[model samples]
Target: MIKRILLALASGALFAVGLVVSGMTQPAKVMGFLNVAGIVDPARFGPWDPSLVFVMGGALLLMLLAFALTPPSRQHPERKPWLADKFELPTRRDIDSRLLLGAALFGIGWGLVGYCPGPALASLLTGGLDAGVFVLAMLVGMALARRWIGRVAA
Candidate 1:
């Protein structure tokens, strides 16, 4: 249990560092990336930031490498890396009303705040009031969702 806790903490710290280094913790950078129409530019194709693309590309490359290294069917526990044992490939889900609603909500939040969950948490380190408020609101939203979903299911 202690080992798991330590590992979780270390992983979170590493993730936060990566967000900061990648400039994902900055709302302006994220907003710039989202300006696909380049309305904020005089060149008409300007104001488009490619930093998010490169960051995502690097992440995808790492994921591909990990997937290649750990085939799903490999049963040689002794030879497999820890990730092979710890993580499973996610199964696909069909588009449903819930999924659509969730996606819409996420997109709306991202566009409005320019900070997803991970980057929002990372931004807390900078002691920014906006980040703090966003994080607090997010937690409340999550809790409300949990309760509402539970009631509906029950």
Candidate 2:
């Protein structure tokens, strides 16, 4: 149990580091980048303020390189415990209403708060009161949702 807890914490620490390094922890910067309104100021530094695009492109390039280096199933048919199964696919056939509804809610929250689920948890490590409040509210919302869904099912 302790080992699992430590592993989880380590993973979270790494994620937080990633968030900080990627500049996702700054709410104002993220909001400015998302809303496409970063270039109007006469005191602005660049012609287009393309820092966000460069960061995103670098992330995408890293992901693509990782995918490219992964060994293909055709080369090694045996499945490893740490690696996902080669032929595993989603069990769903059609787009479910629940999936769509959840995605819409998530997107709206992200847009309004400039903080997605990952970044919210990562922010807790920085020991800020806003992060604490956001996390508490998020947990309460999740609990209420679960209870309401349970009642509806019954």
User: What would the per-residue lDDT of candidate 2 be over residues 1-154, giving only the tens digit for each residue?
Assistant: 6765787789778768888777787666666666644366525632433566887788799868766676656666553222444546588788877779988998887778778777888888776787688789889989998998899789
lDDT digits (tens) for residues 6-105 of candidate 1: 8889989988999999999999899888878785563876678877999999989997887577644446643344533554556876788888998999
- lDDT (Cα) of model 1: 0.85
RMSD of each: 3.3, 4.4
Q: List candidate 2 segments past 4 Å from native.
A: 1-12, 37-50, 73-89
Q: For candidate 1, list the clashing residue pairs, or say none.
A: none
Candidate 1 C-alpha error for residue 40, in Å: 11
What is the number of backbone collisions in each predicted candidate, taken in the order shown? Answer: 0, 0
| C-alpha lDDT (0 to 100) for residue 142 of candidate 1 | 96
